[model samples]
Target chain A: MTLKEIKELLQAEVICGDHHLGTEIILAGGSDLMSDVLAFGKPGLLLLTGLTNLQSVRTADIIEAKAIIYVRGKKPDDQTIKLAAEKNIPLLSTPLMMYEACGLLYQAGIPGVSPANNSNKAND
Target chain B: MTRDDEFRQTFKIKGRDFSHAGGVSTEIKEILQEIGIPTQLIRRVAIASYEAEMNVVMYAQQGKLILSINPETIQIEVEDKGQGIKDIELAMQEGYSTATEEMREMGFGAGMGLPNIKKNSHVFLITSTPGVGTYLKMIFYLDHEKAS
Candidate 1:
């Protein structure tokens, strides 16, 4: 699905990068934990997170996430918004909680970045 | 490229600086992008570098991140002055963490930093002194066939 469809389905507000709404988003992962996102996120993955901090934007950029959808009506500060804009990673705000957001996306045929059968164990 | 043909840069990280955390890693990513590093390799380097930088901001007084790159490899070295890890083996575990509430509030402190770094790098090394500091060196080979 495209980010435009997600925005309409979730009734989300585009906090930044409105120009990027046309971008395609096929995979997503929802988490408040940045480390887990780092571990499991794939390039171009859409990140659905409740954490509204600079690190969220940074994590999205590091993992090459296509965009970030902030759940639970949370929004980041000005610095975080500035960073997101600088990185060209779009930011969207939604009133729904994390679980609901994930469900809606999943129902639309978007899959999680990590497969359910895979273990989270660190191989090191 | 030969050792003589390399790009090197150093960035300083200040502990407890939540406002500016992850900035260095962003710059490093931009540098690597400008140098034409592969997107997949850049993502790996960015993930490992950001994790290392976050550790310094969360636990150290101050630290330095050195990025040295050549045609064959990308290397990152982080040395910090602060309370170091007492048990390296335990710290490398997936769920082990000593992060504070503030760190968690930022969506970190899940105890996956070191292992995540190791998972992304071809070579990972960590050394620390409980009272003194910690040091990390991670290398990623540009050619997967040569990495072993």
Candidate 2:
């Protein structure tokens, strides 16, 4: 699904990367643990998380995640916003809880980035 | 440093700061990439170095991560005189960890740190003295040195 559709599905406001709304995303993962996500994530995946911290953006940058969705309307602090802007990690804040947000995305044909198939893909 | 023969850089890890835990590894990864190291090897070294350094911060009580960067290889040596590990054999097992709740809350208490270091290093060694300290050495080669 396109990032634009994901933004609408979760009722999320695009904090950055508005021009890249047409970017396609296939797999998604939801977790608040930055280390867990870092330990088991593929590049270009979408991360749905409730944790609003600098480390969250840092984790996304380390893994090169496509986007970070802040579930439950938990907007990050200003410093984090600046970091996200710098990293170009397209941030989205949503009112839906983690499970519901993931489910909606899954039903909309956006699948989880399962580890079995998480072998690295070209960033192209 | 994952290049085959470029240059060398060294870093001294400070074990007290939790916020600065991954600093050395990040620097190493950046240097390796800029030195024309392959992404795969760089990632492996980064993971190993980061995990080893975190272990020192969380468990060793205090230590330093000495990173040696050369054109042909990357070596990470963790040396400390802190409370040494009591059981090396048991510690190497997956799912075994001594990390406290605070460390877990930071998202790294999953007991994968040691296993992670061993898995990524082309050469690994650990030595410890109960009353003295612990030392870990790891090496990852960037070149096909066997042919040389």
Candidate 3:
């Protein structure tokens, strides 16, 4: 779905990358741990997290995530906004918590980044 | 362009510096983008490099990252001075982490660093001495026809 639709659906505030609201996002992943995101996230992901650190923006950029949706009324600091702007990664803030945000997106037809197939496991 | 066309760059990483942990990887990604590498290859390289950077930041006193980019391959060598893994085998396990509260606060240290790096890299090599440090060399093969 287009980020524009996500913004409207979640009543999210666009903190940056207003010009790139039309960017399409194929999958969504919500996590507070940057490690998990790095391990599992892929390109064109929409990341939802409550962590408001600059690392969040950095993680999204590294994974080539389309945008970041800050959940639970969480907001990113100026540095995060500057980095997101520089990377052309859109930032959105929503009052809903992580679970709710992810649920809304899932119910709206967005799939998670990956399944429980455990394909990422070395043993599997 | 072929393997003859290669670019090399080095970046320094300081430990426990959460503020700028991923700076080197970000710079590398920008460089790859400017060089017109494929998006998928860039993402893989960036992710692996960033994970290595974080490992250095969270565990070492300092580190050096060398990025070698050829027309058909991208390789990164990360060497760090700090408490190295006593058991490389255990460290490679997916859920084994020695991270502290401070490291966790930065949204990292989930014990997924090495595995994730290996997953993203086409070639992964690592070595460490318990008290000395660690070295990681990761490479990504670029598809000539696929890369823009």
Candidate 4:
């Protein structure tokens, strides 16, 4: 689904990259761990997390994630938002907790980053 | 600049600097993207470099990251001064991390750093002493046809 649709469905606030709302996001992965995100996240994936730090933005940029949704009403600091803008990664925040936000997206057809096959491939 | 040309840069990473961890890798990723590296290759480079940088920040006093870009390859050499891994083999194992609680809180120290770096690089090499330091070298081959 497009980022615009996800934002509207979740009632998320656009924190950065307002111009990219129309971009399509293929996969959604929710995690609080940056390592897991780097190990499993695919390019153009949508990242949902509660961690509000500069590293979150850096992780999304490293994995080339299309956008980040900050769950549980979490918001990034100024440096984090600035970095997101610089990297062209769209940021959004929703009042829903991580579990609820992820469920809403998954129920809406957004697939989570599975591990059975993904883990082996990542280690290989 | 075409494939035949080459460029190189060295970036310094200070240890225990959580505030700016992964900054070097981000810069390298941007440089690779600007140079028209394929998305797949750039992702690999970015992941490998970021992992390496984080290692230095978490475990070392400081480190130097050298990025060498040539027509045929992109190579990163990370050398750090700090507590080095005694058992490189054990360190390579997934889920064998010695990261502290603080590190885990930052969403790292899951013992996947070295393995993930190896998985992302075409060539990965690591050497370390118990107390001296660690040295890592990673290379990614560039496909000329894939170059934009």
Q: Which candidate number would show the highest lDDT if scored against the true structure? A: 1
Query: Is 1 or 2 the stronger prediction by DockQ?
Result: 1
lDDT of each: 0.92, 0.76, 0.88, 0.90
User: In model 4, what lDDT does residue A22 have?
Assistant: 93
Ranking by lDDT: 1, 4, 3, 2
Best by DockQ: 1
| DockQ, cand. 1 | 0.86
For each candidate, what's the DockQ?
0.86, 0.34, 0.76, 0.70
Q: Which tens-of-lDDT digit does each residue in A1-124 have in candidate 4?
A: 8999999999999999999999987788999989889998887789999888888999998998899999999899999999899889999999999888988988887776786644323223
Q: What clash pairs does model 4 have?
A: none
List of chain B TM-scores, one per candidate: 0.96, 0.85, 0.92, 0.93
Better of 3 and 4 by lDDT: 4
lDDT of 3 by residue, B28-128 (tens): 99999998988878888899999999999999999999999876678899999999999989989998989998888899888899999988888899999
Residue B108, model 3: lDDT of: 85
lDDT of 1 by residue, B3-60 (tens): 6888888899999998889999999999989979889889999999999999999999
The C-alpha stretches of model 1 lying farther than 4 A from their native spots are A117-124, B1-3
- Which digits, one per residue and each the tens of the lDDT, describe model 1 over residues A13-121? 9999999999999688899999999999988789999999999999998998999999999999999999999999999999999999999988887877665623322
- Runs in model 2 deviating more than 4 A are A14-22, A77-83, A115-124, B1-6, B60-62, B130-133, B144-148
Clashes of 2: 5
User: What would the per-residue lDDT of candidate 2 be over residues B25-112, giving only the tens digit for each residue?
Assistant: 7677777778787887777777777777777776666777777776556788888767777999988887787778887765576777
**Runs in model 3 with CA error above 4 Å?**
A116-124, B1-5, B143-148
